[model samples]
Target: MDWNSFWEGSKDLSTFALAIRAIILYIALIIATRLMGHRQVGILSGHNYLVAAGIVSLAAIRMLNPESSLTSGIVIVFVYAFVNIFLSYLDIKWPKTIDRKPTILMKDGIIHRKNMLDCHVTIDNLLGQLRLKGAHNLSEIDTIVLEPYGKISVIKKPEALPLTRKQMNLPPKMVALPTILIYDGKIDEKNLHAIGLDHEWLMTKLREKGIANPKDIFLAMLESDGTVYISI
Candidate 1:
């Protein structure tokens, strides 16, 4: 082929390669974001928003830059991955710096108008999100927290009931949140300590439930009523 024809052919090949690279980069970013966690997409906080925006911007540049090589796109992907890992480490080591703390936007059923304004959230939007979460009335909401990730959490006050003993079908019992004793065939030591238990205590409890080993119990619960429920 003549030099002119050869050059033209190479340009066409580069275009095709760039198109493929763009598609791959786009899909990889989506997968990476998903793997990072669901919160990465739902909560657009400081670093999270930047990371998401940067990915889209870089992908566009890769597709548009005809001279951009495959290695350049790969480098961008690695850069994003490293940033995510570093941020996660910071979040673990110093939670206060990395994770956005929840702010009280509403207290005692009264809305903090200044806070709402600062967050760029209106009463209508707040009520809409709350209603979606099954909160029908503002009076029912005890506290509304504006999460760092631009999400609002509504906590409702305990419902009032008649003061008749006959109406109370069950005794006043405090229900403890269920703890994961074993996950993926491995014991969670942190959870054990949280529940004030040790390996020996768990083994003994397992034996009473006819579970030969901790692995035999898929899920176990220790209730405030001093009851142990085991699921295999």
Candidate 2:
């Protein structure tokens, strides 16, 4: 039904059917969540994500028409919110009974291809996640675990955890984040200007590096130490 029918039509008739629909759908959803077990109880997990989409869609569908059911849509939406809260509580109370444990994606610096495939995680996803977790060197990583909520936990090798400046009793140098001047062959004029550098200065640096065009550089960063790091 269209939206015009929802607000303009007989509110009494729509409300009657909507109440029945909401009650039935709500009960059925609760039952489905229970039968599905831990799979659907995950906080923001795939199942929960799908459930949210489906429930929201159903509530929206009931809202578009039948003036009587218009108010039912609001009730259904709030009901779903409470259901999600209930599922979250169940997940916490029972733990594994309603959620799977974190999966090991890699161990001993070796990627578990089979486990990765089973977990539906691709190598690109693994490496990208690892990089975000500061595991730049796979060889220096002891283990990589894929958390249930999609966190990538990394265990670095012993040698990788070298003595820090604090341990050595040495003064730490000021940390300066490198300004990205170019990325994917495109120049970032705003960042360049923010760093007090202009297009001419960038061109000069590129010329010194034997690069005739900024488009040839895939990534270019201007360091605080007056150095330009380029990756083509």
Candidate 3:
């Protein structure tokens, strides 16, 4: 085979074919990433970032290699997909291995220097987050947690002279997050099953609200306190 002629022929393939391959690869990567879960995106730890980089790099290589058959590119995509799926299953089954260690930045109002060193976190980062949280001073904090997602969670210590409940004047309890049963006129069966209800129950609820079909409702929610709200 003449290598130069082969390269020339490969370059001569229709632009539409190249565009379609790019689109297909993009869609596959998106689906695979979503299947991996949102934690993969939020917690860009060293390991997680490496995994994401590897996936993108592989896809880009396959996209540029026009000489490689489409079937070969798809096979590579599926291989990565399968590996991700298997790892995700293992993580769910044995969470301890995949679970991240909690970095204790503070305990009993004292900073844990050892933990900070291990996690490579500096006092400046911690103080910056604290300031964002409206903490005027470190002395006001009782405890602080450096969450796996790189967020600093702070709790204020109770004052030496405790205030009465009435004096504190705490706000009323906020309502729980609404459960979306239907989105964009489609019944979310997985969400329904998660909340221990089925399609029949959903239909019955809709009928009571004068909605004959799930498609007629633009949004449907079930609050934790057993309140059902629907919008058409």
Index of the highest-TM-score prediction: 3
Residue-wise C-alpha lDDT for candidate 3, range 1-232, written one tens digit per residue: 4344233326555566666667877888787778767756764343455567777787787578666555555566667666766665666687558646557788898999999998888888888898898886888788888876577788888873357655779765556677899887998888899878988898898888888978878889998777788888
After TM-score superposition, what is the CA distance of residue 148 in candidate 2 from its true location, in Å?
Answer: 0.9
Score each candidate by Cα lDDT. Answer: 0.72, 0.74, 0.73
- Poorest stretch of ten by lDDT in candidate 2: 1-10
CA lDDT, candidate 3, residue 95: 56
Tens digit per residue, CA lDDT, model 1, 1-232: 3333222223445445555666766777777776667646764457878877887787676667655554556677667867876786687698778887777889988999998888788878898888888887888878999887777788877672225444667666565776777764578899889878899988888888778877766777775666777778
Which 10 consecutive residues of model 3 have the lowest summed lDDT?
1-10
Superposition error at 54 for model 2 (Å): 3.1
lDDT of 1 at 122: 85
Name model 1 segments beyond 4 Å from true. 1-11, 14-16, 23-44, 160-232
lDDT of 1 at 127: 82
Worst 10 residues of 1 by lDDT: 1-10
Write model 2 residue lDDT over 1-232, tens digit each, in one string. 4445443335445565556555655665666556555645654464467566867587556644444454455555556666665766787798677766789887887888998999899988988998787778888998888877787889888889889898899998767888899999999989999878898999999999999998999999988776899999
TM-score of candidate 1 to 2 decimals: 0.57
Give candidate 3's total backbone clashes. Answer: 0
Ranked by lDDT, the better of candidates 1 and 2 is 2
Residue 187 alpha-carbon offset, candidate 2, angstroms: 38
Clash pairs (backbone) in predicted model 3: none
